[model samples]
Target: MPSGGARASIDLSSATIAVTVHRQGATVPILIDGRIVMPTGVAIGPTGQLYVGLDHAAARALPADHRYVDNPTDLLGTPTHTHDAAPPDPVELLAAVLRQTTFYAAHQIGQPITELTLTIPPHWGPRRRGHLDDAAHRAGLPAPTLVTAPAALTAYATTLGLTVPPNSCVLVCQVDRHPATLTVLQLVGDHYRELATQQITTPHDLDHLIAHRVIDAATPDDDPLRTTINHPPDAPADDRHALLESVRAARHLLVEHDRAPVLLPAPRQPAVITRDDVTTATQPFLDTAAHTVKEVLDAADVDTAHLAGVIVRPAPGIPALTERLAHATGTTPGVVDHPHALADGALALTAAHQPGPRAAAARLPRVRLRITDLAGILALGACSLILLLQPVLTADITTVDSYVVGARTSVPQIGSSGAFAMLTALVIAHLAPTTWLAGTPTGSPAEPTTGSLIRRGYLAAAVSGLITATLYGLATGTALELDYRPYLTWTLGAALPLAACTALIAVTAPRIPADALPTWLALARPAIHYALLAAAGMFLMRAALSLTIPVDLTGMPGLVGSLGAALLGAATILTITDSRVLRALAVPGVAIAYALVFTYSTKSALIVAYLAALTWWAVRLTTKTLHLAFPNAGAALHRLVNRPHS
Candidate 1:
């Protein structure tokens, strides 16, 4: 879940339908007016008779060539016989079923269904997906969006308020009639990337195993029921199908009951099956399922400790598999109980993000430098030029720098010209162009004129110039030995306007939308904001103390060196820990420690705070630049930074 809420708020309407086709059948589950309406899975028979859900039993009683179960797995292979004459194209049959399912859902909801989303197995490649798309088109419907079942399961998990943070891994285990699929999906950005997937064949089907158990309990050793259970394919199709269907129903009934009766074949009594019987029958399958999950995790190079969550979509017979998966992954697994859970997931994903290549392209940051950016660059260049020329232009002048350099000497120093330029550049850098901190506002108009930007730049430069000149005069008048009173007054006067400017820039600057930001930047945005806030506070503290506390100008060098070393040591220690709150608290704690240690002469403390704030800002900017240039490395570094201490 995001800070606001779950990211799976789907905007479903009558025009859209979500269909899931798996080993058993096809389901159309639609959400309308906050209610879920699922129509029965439909099929077509050899005689062109339409079979809907349970009515499929009648179609199954027909000859082998006249009826067939519409299993999605068959799409991976050649076409099969669904009719007596020319076999229907597997793609055509699937399309027809989807079309029919759509119509059925629309009729039930009393609305037209235009858009379709189909969920398939994770291992499905482009070819299989293409087949599904072709079927949708052949059915006279628009090309359907295809989503992987594992990804869909994750979407469903979000609906349950399960939070899988970015860069974390989620293990999804789905046990159906065909084979158990174990997939490790990592949440990269807003979507999930498949890390590893494996389809493991269980030694025996849960339903078949339960059916066998029921026969053993209800019949004699030499009874026909025993023979039917032993040789299922050779038994009468209707009897075997009916018995299996009844067993499946009993297994589901056991979900809410301790025991349920399974209807046996004719001439036999119904066998009462217990929940214990279902659990026992599923033990082998559960064992294999757990092992498969472990293997997939290993393949994905994801440790159990790093897993964000575990989700299980168990077959109708084995909800107990959830516990087995939980034990395997060391995380409680969320069980998906809805029969059309995959379809629901697919719909959520579709609504949240666009599918296919278009979505992939959309995730990339699209940035283009505009006129305001160029104006900012020019302003910075001019400021740099002034700073560079100040030394040469003032070489002949002897300036007293008792405040910074101990004693007056004939040397070039950071005079009015250079300080003004530096401050101007800083202000322009924050105000003129959009940055992560100062982004372009959504739905804002075009950039301000270059002249307007330049005027703002010069206004900032003039303020910095006056402040520097006033400080210089005060330093010289007091013989560079001013007490805390005058310094504190100057600091407060300067800080007030600087803070106002910063706030104004933050409010007026255009902000980039969160979606447009790179994943690494988006994930680090909160941390970056905190860092900037801490840096700003430190800078303010430095401005106040650098002038206020009287200092022995002679020992300033040694005092400054000691403060720098202490601040560096503190930063190094703080960086090693991953606790954000601790890091945030440590910033002010270090400042207070410095203030106490250098109470008699806070000039060194002032220098240390200023350098610390500047260094912090520089590092944050460098990190943002590196992440934007090399996202993969940035993501890795983010994981490293967020990793637990252990």
Candidate 2:
């Protein structure tokens, strides 16, 4: 806090940048002897580090007679704005920042930059992040750890003096057009703890906020910018348009809305929001929010009688919403000015309550362990590896264990191709969640979706493989003779499990929820159950085949052939029945007749394919029925629940 405490050395004036500090005749915040200036005309490295952008606007801001050591072209965003400079490469952008900073810090200030930090938007991506880190390595600065937009907002929140009460709850509600976030914080000794963070958006808040802001911003008497809908009304609102709209809305509110308790940007109008206005604007958001608060209380095992009143931080919308929540819950709630709660709290939590960098894995969403004993990061790594190698691994149409159509015929080729396809699927599944997300959103739906079916099918296959392998090992099966029909018999065996597993799933699937468990755990449950069911199906199919057929295909290795054959049948039955037990059972009855009428030359591959088709159709049908029963007007879990609406 002293004026001359040693500073990090970096010359801020070498470039055409200026630093401005609002202290009483004091210098700007600087690292090492130079001043700190607000960076402008910049792009972010993949990792969200800020890089001086090459847009002419940046140069334009600099004095006409400024000079630097490095050429502009060496940095990313090479071509000037008028010349259509290739948008800065993310990695180069990151490298440029470090290079520039390091050059200033080292040669200019005689110090190796050891620590670095950056502020970035919340929705940063992985690829871009890698480039930023790479750039930091090339430069002398230590690679930065990400600080989210909300967390950054915290710096501002603390300055505004928002505090939570003892034993009292504080809910920080942040609203943006794309989403509404509610994070409840409970104050404790010199720190606060997280109660909950919900990912639900209400319809009232879902509209293009920019449009509304612009409408609100425009004053009847004095308007500045003419508003135009860039694309059609239904076309998605772009970033530029959204920002402009926000500016306009703030202006409008300044002039029109009664800014009493909460101040508006206008000098005369303080922000005004009544409790009733908040309740009406938010509606049932409070209902679910209140429930969540109660649940949080129960989870923490906190008694309200021992607590201080509640605290509410209103986001973009009316502040009254927080008050309404307080009223409904019978807890006296306190209020904080919005926008900076998350960031400020993050810093406080770090210093006080948080597990710190040492136990960071437990706090990170990516590393959090699920009840199913799966780690998201590991799953993601596996998926990425699979997708990257899919073309090679699953290069075959027909495999050695399974038949191929329009695929390579050789055995080695089958293995290679199978691996490639699987790898590809694994990669694709992670990157594009549509396939996985297609399933019913509800933790428990009467009927599942295509996504669920696919998820379940793959799951069944995996579990069945393990079970079959375990059984085969127990039997100590030796290298036996391999014949075409017998090989085919083994292939069919794989399908049998899939079919039988799906059938059993169809029967009891409704009783237990698919989504209720943690994501990793939930994903495994369906697969494991399906595997057991399919295994049962195969056992029965072989029993029937050996008893009836004269030259049985029973003597197959790994029980794989039978499962392969049964898979298609089981999947088909489940798919066709729309998750109806009666309808699915009837599928076997019909298939038997069809096989009798068509031909006795039944192939295992054909059966598996048949079951696959059935699974698809049945899931689609079941989902339709489920959708009718419980449509997703809001959160998937929220809709399916039998809450007994009075």
Q: Per-residue lDDT tens digits of candidate 1, residues 31-131?
A: 43234532233355666664433234655665664545445335445555455466545676666556666655555544445456777777778887788
Q: Which 10 successive residues of model 1 have the least lDDT summed?
A: 1-10
**Cα lDDT of model 2 by residue, 1-646, tens digit:** 1111111212111122221111111222333235333232344434444545233334334443332222221333233343423344435544564465445544443333333444333334565455556766766555554444333333335445544445455544444323445454555554445555554444434223333333343333232222333333544323334444343344335334543143222333333333344444355565555566665556556555534444443444454456656665566554544322333333333322221121101111122223333343244334323322322223234345653333222221112122222222223232221223333333333434433443454445434433432332222212122223422333234334433443443333332222211232233222222322333333333333332222235664224334534543554455344357765667676455434432113543444444355335434433443442233434557646856677
TM-score of each: 0.50, 0.30
Query: How far off is residue 174 in model 2, in Å?
Result: 2.9
What is the RMSD, in Å, between candidate 2 and the native fold over all Cα?
A: 25.6
Off by over 4 Å in 2: 1-140, 143-170, 176-178, 185-195, 203-248, 255-313, 328-646
* C-alpha lDDT (0 to 100) for residue 598 of candidate 2: 27
lDDT of 2 at 518: 24
